[model samples]
Target chain A: MPEGPTLAQLGEGELIRRLGAFAPPGQFDDDAALLGAALLGGRPAGDPPLVLNTDVLVEDVHFSAATMGAADVGWRAAAANLSDLAAMGCRGAVGLTVALVAPGHTPWAWVEGAYAGMAELLGSHGGVLLGGDCSGGRQRLLAVTALGRLPAGGGPIRRGDGRPGDVLVSTGAHGISRLGLAVLRGEALPDLPAAGRERAIRAHRRPVPRFDAVAALGASRPAALDWRVAGCDSSDGLATAASCLAVASRCTALLSRSDLPLAAELAGQAQAEDWCLWGGEDFELVLALEPAWAEALVEQLEGARWIGRLVEPQPWGPLGWTEGGGPIASPTAAFRHFG
Target chain B: MPEGPTLAQLGEGELIRRLGAFAPPGQFDDDAALLGAALLGGRPAGDPPLVLNTDVLVEDVHFSAATMGAADVGWRAAAANLSDLAAMGCRGAVGLTVALVAPGHTPWAWVEGAYAGMAELLGSHGGVLLGGDCSGGRQRLLAVTALGRLPAGGGPIRRGDGRPGDVLVSTGAHGISRLGLAVLRGEALPDLPAAGRERAIRAHRRPVPRFDAVAALGASRPAALDWRVAGCDSSDGLATAASCLAVASRCTALLSRSDLPLAAELAGQAQAEDWCLWGGEDFELVLALEPAWAEALVEQLEGARWIGRLVEPQPWGPLGWTEGGGPIASPTAAFRHFG
Candidate 1:
């Protein structure tokens, strides 16, 4: 019999870790992080341009057909693809997806049903299906290859570029998806109010990308602090996202416990505050700005709020938590899949 | 535990008919040398463009660790991707691949080894690794998407363009892959003794595309026949390929049995002609050309021979024949999956 939490019970980290085993020649690209490792060796002695990222979603494991329909899968699939695009701070995607399914399982009706969900997202995002081949039976896997047009100025916004004193900023709050997962898990409402939990659920199920924030970053063209700054989508909560960006930028970001966005519903899951810090799938943009850009940064965003600042590199903890062991610049609640 | 006949027994017709559950939206371009339906949608509007195709090979079913070594699987995977590009008449692929696998099951060494195979193929074909993703997994899934630069006046070569007098030609012989499959099935090679059979085995294991044929077709540009002539790759076999092209073009094909290309070894497992006729995975381009260009094509191809012709519409059958008793222009065989 299937044991131990039926994938639904496992945290995202553990799940990803387990899935990592099957990955062939994998790196940070699948996680929406930049490819800092030199992709080219000694062909002509030129730096490699364009950060290539890819992600794949599976059925039953990622989403239950019993819970979300094919349309939801389709929509999520596009969202997932777009998240990779946003993670790199690039324009729209020239994406292609490979779908494998059981014969009768993927009848045209089901595929069309799935397309309807994808169309809902694509109608707004503007990427049409290039082409796909359908093969029968093999755990339906959707592999989306998104070709992102890198910015003309430099390249993809990477994490290791951040420096100390950089003000940490996130486009949105965290724990919505975690809360949503909790709600779907049939957990009883906690002491916190139900409204926030509902919002969390909505955010998780129908997450949106921070295209606007990325666009703003691109338009600002702040190359000076840009090298000292870093960015990546907070798909795996603020903390993981922040840590990833910090690693790429080679700096540590301190997140103030108070700043970690925590909705009351988080209490229903594990640690409400922790989930906000570490819980993932928010799809928000976590940015580290120079302290001097703090005021202007806040003004630039329609509703941007200051979070924290980059500090000397710390070996112990990740990006979202501070030195005192509380939430800081990144999400506190971490996601785990395996152990 | 595994039951049923080999994939060759299933045939290509049934496989496609099964996939018909998903109705593909398409353009009305046809050159009826019946084969699997060529999709016209996905690209720009009204640009009869050659298609770009790709596929993902996952561990377990597509190729298992027990039978295929990692490098073999890797080589086969690239071959599969190249097969699609070849089918589309593209020079080669210009993209990357995303491979997901279980971390413990697949070590860094294993992945690097597999990549060795990919690098080998790409080097030969001059394809750069555009980008790719790797993830830990319970099973290994390799998803590859390739980009192709189509010729100015080439795209989806209509299958319906063949006229009654148009002669049929293939880049090379078909059914080699099927014969190869027989060898893979542990059949002794001491069956029938034909030179073509050995070649067929190689075709199945490591098939190569015929760019020479493509160049010839383009350079010759035969226009003797009234109808618009077209060309497509025979993935399943000349039979099924001809069927789809015919259906799309709304025409009939009279395949010549005498022109069938088969290798020497037939007595071992299955009949050579039977296997070749209905065999799948022959990545050979089957061209429907005008009679006037026949000699020139032969001259261009040197030894390439004309095998059949286009005919008026009729049902496929007559056993070792097409359905209508229309005098057997030739006894072309049929390849159907699940028949």
Candidate 2:
């Protein structure tokens, strides 16, 4: 046996906590790293900050050939990083660099298809392919680094900027991607409608980054608030995202069970609530905003819903949901790579 | 048997050539991508250009625990990307982002040691750790994206900027790292001195990026030429680096075998010349300069050697060498990932 603790024993969160010690303070606290004017010396004031985010997708671990094509793998990899940039309030991407490693015996067509997928996504979205490196390895992986820029006069939406009475808003319903993965995996979901199944699978394979939501928020922001909103992406599920925001802000998030956004297709499904709360890879924006701003934005933005509120820390924990005026237990555990 | 072609059949160069079509024109044509003032909008005129390079190191492919410790692995990963920055004429790094993928069974100590190594390298050099992502995978890999900056008044040293009459200069000797690898592999070298063996091993494990050499070149540069120098690093052996420069510049590089720099420890080794010409991972700069500037630089910079000159392409190929006033065949092959 190994003499020291293994990654499996520590879990991803603990590992990340320890690894944070090696970086500049709070470098890992945000959804993406913001290289502001201060970091980028000699930059003109009002110039947009550069936002950077990196995500690594490994074969078998993140995806399988049975579930998605090489194109979907590439699209998902790019989407994941773009989603992080959006969470950090980037308006558009500059470009991205991909570091790819694959087995020698991998087909050339697969590589071509992956690039095509990335090209398609970038064409529809806002970035170009900058450059990258390629190498051969036993297992295939793509590490994508995306560079984005905030809009003029916009500021980064940090995770720790929430205040008491801030409203928690979710940009879209969760669990769709999780359902899509299940559909691709051929799991038994007899109650899911055919159209729902199709939507879910597409969501899983080609989840869109929530840049549109970011645009809506920016447009609907109250003049008084300026960019003081707290935000994160629900890539790790709704509960986890809310909890992260709450923990970072030193507040308690009290969510409304009835107000939780649920996909139309998932309305009558038995397991929809559980999946909505805990299923990963939704890639939707979860924001903490002043109540008036959140109310106005939710009214203007399609599919946006006010689901929770921040308050002083409760004795129980950082996150909880209310059902018919009583507090319900919250699940603290989130997705862990090692676990 | 399964497809039209595989990565191994295409090799790294051909694959890169094909992949280049997916990126912006000339994105993959340099050692690192230079984001100039135009690309980074609203930047001041005197501000430096940002240089970006991403390199992926896979376990058992780029490194093995049997040959080096985890800390060395981390150091090497950072060094490889930093070398690319140096080759592109970066004065200093902004920072680096590392995307790491490893198995759950990996010991926590290994991760700690790796970060420690990166910290040590960054502490000595100019960058800080920015941010990164982590994931679980079957094999361990690190994709490091290094961000650097060109000097305020300097421009990028592009691979294709060489002139027909330019002289070729090498920053330092090559093949020490390759010899170090051999020593680490326990290859027998009866005539090798113990100190020489130790030096070779260290060279392989802790190969330094030649930013120092870049600084020296910058300080010694003549005013007339500005920053028009052409250059590349000898990470893929001297012959390959020269050949790339020749091909890119549309000229023929005729090297002087007698003038090749050899390490003092390798003075009497039988295979020293062969290793010096063809061994990889030397991390030394190979520069193209005006004859007068080259002469001056060679005189001013320690261990710098004027080894060759660029001429019109010959019918045979882009690279050749002369020994005893007679032309000798040049090796065309370099390190390849899939091959």
lDDT for model 2 comes to 0.85
Sliding window of 10 residues with minimal summed lDDT for model 1 chain B: B28-37
| Candidate 1 lDDT tens digits, A1-339 | 332343334444444454444333444333342333243221122322334455666665566665566777777777877876776766554443444443333444455566666667766774555454444434555666544444444456656667777788876667778777777777665564667766766776677756666666655545455433477777656777777766666666677776766654565455677667766777877877776555565677764567777787777645545547543443333333221
CA lDDT scores, all candidates in order: 0.57, 0.85
Per-candidate DockQ values are: 0.16, 0.75
Candidate 2, A171-257: lDDT as tens digits: 999988888887888887877889889998999999888888888888888887667889999988898899899999998888898
- Clash pairs, candidate 2, are A180-A200
Q: Best lDDT goes to which candidate? A: 2
Model 1 Cα displacement at B222 (Å)?
Answer: 7.3
lDDT tens readout by residue for model 2, B1-339: 567789999988899999889988888898878887666665665677788889998888888998989888888888888999999998667788999899999999999988888887877776878889999988888999988878766678999999899999999988888888878898766688999999998888888888888888888888776677889998888878888998999988889978887777676777787778888888899999998789878888889999898988878788887553334454566566885
Worst 10 residues of 2 chain B by lDDT: B322-331
- For every candidate, what share of the true interface contacts is present? 0.09, 0.78
